[model samples]
Target: MAEHTIHFGILGCASIARRNSRAIKLAPNCSISALGSRSLERAKKFAKENEYPAYVKLYGSYEEVLDDPNVDVVYVPLPTSLHVKWAVLAAQKKKHVLLEKPVALNLKDLDVILEACEANGVQYMDGTMWMHHPRTPKMREFLSDSHQFGKLKAIHSVFSYNAGEDFLKNDIRVQPDLDALGALGDSGWYCIRAILWATDYEMPKTVTALREPEFNEAGVILSCGASLSWEDGKLATFYCSFLTNLSMDISALGTKGNLRVHDFVVPYQDHVGRFYVTSDLGWAGIPEGADPPPTVHSIETDLPHEAHMVAEFSKLVENIKSNGGAPETKWASISRKTQIVVDAVIASIAKGFEPIEIN
Candidate 1:
């Protein structure tokens, strides 16, 4: 390894690169050293606008950036369909990768990414930032071992936002050939990831889906509903939509009580209120508001940062430096499973909501 900071390179000038570029500049051990794009003018323009260091090279072609001997890691923010190709090339170039989410369109592409990373002795991590947010683990901790929620019987979750006619009017998210998994792949993946994380369920035994026609062009499922099971009797339901205004909600039902998280998706603003439950005295709030029993403990915490991407990126770099690999098995496994469930759901919808086994 080089003695100076881990010299980084960016593969595209997408909006996401703008966000991660901030973190790259701030982190002590990382620096964006190169910018690559299909267009030379665009590459130079992005580099100039971002004010990357003077020595940071700009390249007309992605290959030029990867071919550069000094670039150590490549941050890929390409469209979902393009992720696998560049990721494989990055790995083949012996560069570490922080790939954008949906990791790839399907399992085959994901496998290629994994193989490329392994072959080149480089590390790879999907940019599914929400999975690494401290808020999620905190939420899980609060729910565990609690009579307030008894034993969780079922979980229902929803995450959606109207991308509006503007996106459909121009963006590839609405293009049929490009919109393989539909909005579900783009935004709904989180809803699936969060629910599976909270319940710690194995791959859903079966998946069914419902999606609107407009999503055919969006490269995502505009709206979807899926049901999943863990063991013999545990069941869960999840939904995601792009046709409606934004929402982030989750409800965990229990034998004795339930827990609901309002605006749980983005975690950008300060959220109050307790994890409410039905109690002996009637309904009561716990955590940030209302009164609670001595036996019922409440937790008050905030999901800081306007975005969780930086936090996860920081953790990813630190973990690789210290532990020589990605996060624990449960975390990595959940990421793969997240993609798996989305794939199954899309397949089901293609077959008219026919149930598909996850395996």
Candidate 2:
């Protein structure tokens, strides 16, 4: 590996890893140097199918990936339950960690992962792909504009995908042991992160899970919704499921304006993204005609959002390795806030849909 390049070792062969593998390849200073899975044959197959270099190392266990001296970073695409285990181990091994979203089953486990990374002087980041998209900053710019957007009044986010019979019956997301949080952890993670992003990571004063979350026979969530309220009376609501038509949206309403994004979680395409905004929206000519249509803004990116995430993470790793820079805490902070809200939502559901206060 070149001195400036950050070598990445993948810890799982989950379906999401394929997209991440391509992203690693797309990043300028990163390489997918190794892959590890419980089944060596599966690891080998993943390498071949993903078109990784012939020299890429394949190991039979995740620990070996962390043990590799050449690996400067480890990407954990494991299930939520396994995150703290593998992510902490990788951090203890002095390898920077890029973990998949829903950083853990709860905030306590997320803290364990964060502490390990901090103690080991390794960078930590969650794999929230949309956060690295160029469109995000543009949207934030509009939301922060006092004259155009005024004060935020409400936020509504929804993310869902209709899982077919095979997925509903066999997917790990609906399994009790593999992904216990189910749709809440898988789909709702994005919704919560979107809400947090729009609100600049402010913690809501209380969170209440909507009544009657749909669950499978194993008692895993298949669909759910929640409402969050801030101390200043700002409100946000989110819905997530595995039983609806594919949709990813975030609509933020303010006193003077509103913003709408149809593809906030994953864009319609990799190269370009779009969003709409209507500022100072009101009646014109005594309700005879409304103001002009919402302005549509499109952003074009040379690399995919996942690739941008990889590149950003790798840059931090490179800085720490070569320049003796301290690990960036911003990503870890955001992950913690997201997990806190997720835990509150779970608590509310367990308490029979009562609001859970956040401290």
Candidate 3:
């Protein structure tokens, strides 16, 4: 914390890495000190294109990046399957880790990554950037206000995309080794996370899953629904899919009012949109215009680097510098629970739509 800057290394040259690289550059007191890729030419090219400093090294192997003494932290933006392996290796070297989302393919791998971090006394965290956004903080605060949404009633969330066959053909997101990435993990996780995040993971005492298997190809889930406990005496329904055209929306209903957010997942560069709300009193619109409304804020730039990657990586740096590091909380717990729901959906499909309750 004493220094004005922190040196870091990137472990992959994928598109995710490119976004994280730009975020680190933008974050105060953080810098990409090195980069590594499986291909020597790729590593060199990436380093040159980014104008990484002379001290910033380029390595053909990720291990070399981990071994760099100048590298205080490691950003692993590799495939979903490789997340656990690289996290463990970086932790072994006593390097703080900024791991990509989903943490790992399953809970077992997530435990190992956490164990490695604990054993090595290094910080490790999954980068759920949206959860760290200023709006997220505001959402939490608003949800607590009695007049904001009144007593909770039910909630619904949706996140869908038409990832054409071309993407599935070559992307690891669709590989069997990667757990047949489909609606469940590919885009569905966003919906699950949103529910847990919005509700503070307070509901969902028991979850029953149902999947529309026809939307799945190669055994990957395409559409899913879950019956969850919305409140003490109420229940909520959830839905997500990746086979649809495109949709990203969330709604939380209550006795007094309701909050509906449209295009929630990825807002535009200008963040211009209308989030509608209705109550017994009347209807109102919270428009994100040149200036965002209260409780809603836009990223600092019109560029792509303004993505959630900034908030995600910044949290890693802040935790690493805080000595004992940030305390683990419902965030980690809810992610594990969400994965269980995904598994339950898979089980339901295998059982001919027989609903399975999440333990």
Quantify all predictions' global Cα lDDT against the true fold: 0.68, 0.92, 0.67
- Angstrom error of the Cα, residue 218, model 3: value is 2.9
Model 1, 1-359: lDDT tens per residue? 22235667889888767767766775545677888999999998888787777788899989988999988778888887887889999989878787877677887777778777767767666666655445556556656756645677788888778878877565655555554666677667777877777676556677766544344433445677787776656677777777878877777776766667756655544333234444323433455574554342234434332234444454555566556875333434556778788788767878987888876
> How many clashing pairs per prediction, in order?
13, 0, 0
Lowest-lDDT window of 10 residues in candidate 1? 297-306
lDDT of 1 at 72: 75
Ranking by TM-score: 2, 3, 1
- TM-score per model over all chains: 0.81, 0.97, 0.83
- Candidate 2 C-alpha lDDT tens digits along 222-297: 9999999998989999999999999999999999999999998889999998999998866662354644668899
Model 3, 1-359: lDDT tens per residue? 22235677889887767666766776665777888899889999988887666767889999998899978789887877888889999989988777776567777777788788778767665555555544555555546667766877777888877778777575666666764646667666777777766676763666667544434456655666766663276566667765677887778777776667766666543334335555554434544463333233333433342344544554655565665575344444666766666666566667776766655
Candidate 1 Cα errors over 4 Å, as ranges = 1-4, 27-29, 211-220, 270-332
- Our tally of clashes for model 2 stands at 0
Q: Which candidate is the best by lDDT?
A: 2
TM-score of 1: 0.81
Q: lDDT at 324 for candidate 3?
A: 54
